[model samples]
Structure formats: structure tokens, C-alpha cells
Target: MQITASTVSLTVADVAASQAFLTAHLGYTVQAAADGFASLTRADAVDIVLLARGTQVLPPEQRDRHAAGLILAFTLADGLHDQEKRLREAGVEITMPLREEPWGERLFQITDPNGVIIQFVEWATSDDT
Candidate 1:
């Protein structure tokens, strides 16, 4: 089977809060929204669906569960440092400062208002490693 698109649905305490964070900081556009739900999209990123905690649309067993211990990581084609600087300059807290791993991975992280961890990564070249 082939996947046409990708989306990540997150159950957040406050849908509006997480929606605002994704739109304002991550360049996501609101595709749709309702009292307790929001759909966000970006050309170069995965689509996002924000659902209010306890929303009935979710199965009973999953309704109360929140997005935790999950890191939504995006690998950038380039300019990882520049993106980090831009986010920092925009008053977005850098939860994890930019650092390079021994395995040639350069990455950083930030936590949204709903406590969703978003990570940006870039791979280093042999010369840079």
C-alpha cells in the first residue's frame, strides 16, 4: 500500500492553546477548527490534528490519554541552526539547545504549550563530522 499523506493527532488539555502554538511558531495553517478540534497543515511538514482531552470522538479507552513521552521530530533539509535561532529570537523557549551527536546528527527541541515535544534535526556530512 502507498501512503498519500501523514498526520499526527494529539490529545491536548487545551486544543486552542496547542493550535495557536503550532500555527504561530511552526508556520502551520489552520485547515479546519471546531469547538474542541483543530486541523493544521504545512507544505513541508506533517499535518496535525488537535483534539481536546476527553473529546467523545476518541474511543473511551483513549479519550483520557494525553500526548506525552512522544517527540514529533522533523528532519530539515538544511539550515537547522538558522531555524533554531529564528525560533529563539521569536521568544520560543529552546527546551533543548542545539547540539551535535557523535553519530552525525544535529538536533534541538522545543515543547509546545500542551507539553508536546517537537524536535528538529539535520545530519552532518563526513567532512563536518
Candidate 2:
């Protein structure tokens, strides 16, 4: 199959809040927007779609659902610490402080306004481990 692109759609109680958070902090730009929906994109990151909770476009069984227990993660090739510092300088709350794992993973997390966890990760080299 030939897949061109991918996007993650998040059903949030406040679509605007999530949209704003992504655009302001994560460097996402609005690709499109409507009363209850918004499409955001970043040049080198995953695209995001924000849908209001209970949006009519959703199937009846899923219309009331909200994005919970989901961690949208991005794996960066480098600069994890610099990115964390930039986020902190911008006043974005760091839900999970920077830490390194025994498995050579360095990461941190932040909670969006709607409580969706966003994680940034970088793998450590053998020397750094």
C-alpha cells in the first residue's frame, strides 16, 4: 500500500484549547478549522486533528468519547534537553520531568490543556548510557 501521510485525531472537550496549545507550543500551524474541528500540521512532526467531544462526525458509539489514556509521542534524533529547556522557558508545564531510563531512553512529557500526554524522546548512545 502507498501511504502518503498520517495524522492523529484527538477528540477533546475543548477543541480550541487543544488547537491553541499545539500551535503555540508545539509549532503546529492551522491547516484548516471549523466550529468544532481543526487540522494542524508541523513541518517535521506528526499532523494533528482536533475534534470537539461529541462531534457529530463521530460514530454514535464514539461521539461522546474524549482522548484519554493516550500518550502522543515523538522520537527526536537529538536535542531532547534543548527542547525541554525551550518548553520550560515558554512557561509550558512539564508533567514529567526529564529523565533517562536504564534502556537508554531519555524523555519527558507534558499534558495538554485537555490532558492528553505528549512525550518527547531521544535514545542515548552507548557512551552516554
Candidate 3:
């Protein structure tokens, strides 16, 4: 079987906050939205769908702790620092400032409302801001 597209949905307490964070920091475009549900997609087809917990998916406790551990990881084809600047300008708190991994990749991190850690990485130097 071939997996063409995939989306990981999160049961969120506040849809607006989640939407705003993703849109403002990561440049995700809203593909669908309502009072209880929302879907944000990136140009790379990465999707972040938000739904009200206990109504759309599981309870708050059942959410994958993976989000807290790794949260979400996004690869940046554009300049990593520039994106960091934008997120910072939007008042988004960055937990881990831009740092280079020993593996030779440039990466940074932030946390969402629920304390989910989000990661951004650049694997190549071709991306110049």
C-alpha cells in the first residue's frame, strides 16, 4: 500500500489558539474550520487538524504523549532563522533557540498551548534567508 497523504489530528481545548499558532508561526493555511473543528495545511501537504477533545477524538488524557516528547517536526526549505524571527515577532515563545545538532542539522523548537513541543529543522545549507 502506498500512503499518499497523511494528517495527524489533535484533540484541542482551544481551537483558535492552536490555529493562530500554526498559521502565524508555521505558515499553515486553513483548509477547514468550524466552532469545533479545524484543518490547517502547509504547502508541503503537511496537515494539522484540530478537533475538540471528548467530542471528536479521545479524552485529554489519552492524547499521544509523543506530542509532548517530540510534539511535531517540520523541515524548513527556507531560512530557519528567518522563520524563527517571524515566530518571535508574533510573540510565540521559543523553548529552544536556534541550535545546530551534532548531526549537522540546524533546528529549533517551540511549545504549543498544551505544552506540545514543535520542532523545525534545516538539513542543508542551501536555505539562505
Which residue pairs show backbone clashes in model 1? Answer: none
When summed lDDT is taken over every stretch of 10 residues in candidate 3, the lowest stretch is 62-71
RMSD in angstroms, all models? 0.8, 0.8, 3.6
Candidate 1: RMSD over Cα atoms? Answer: 0.8
Model 1 Cα shift for residue 117 (angstroms): 0.2
**Rank by lDDT, descending?**
1, 2, 3
lDDT for model 1, on a 0 to 1 scale? 0.95
In candidate 3, which residue pairs get closer than 3 Å at backbone N, Cα or C atoms, i.e. clash? none
What does candidate 1 score on TM? 0.96
Candidate 3 structure quality by residue, lDDT tens digits, 1-129: 998778987766777888887887677999999886889998685688887655635556765323334468888776889988988888889899998876668888988886668889988554432
In order of appearance, the predictions have TM-scores of: 0.96, 0.96, 0.78
Error of 3 at 71 (Å): 2.1
Which of candidates 1 and 3 is the stronger one according to lDDT?
A: 1
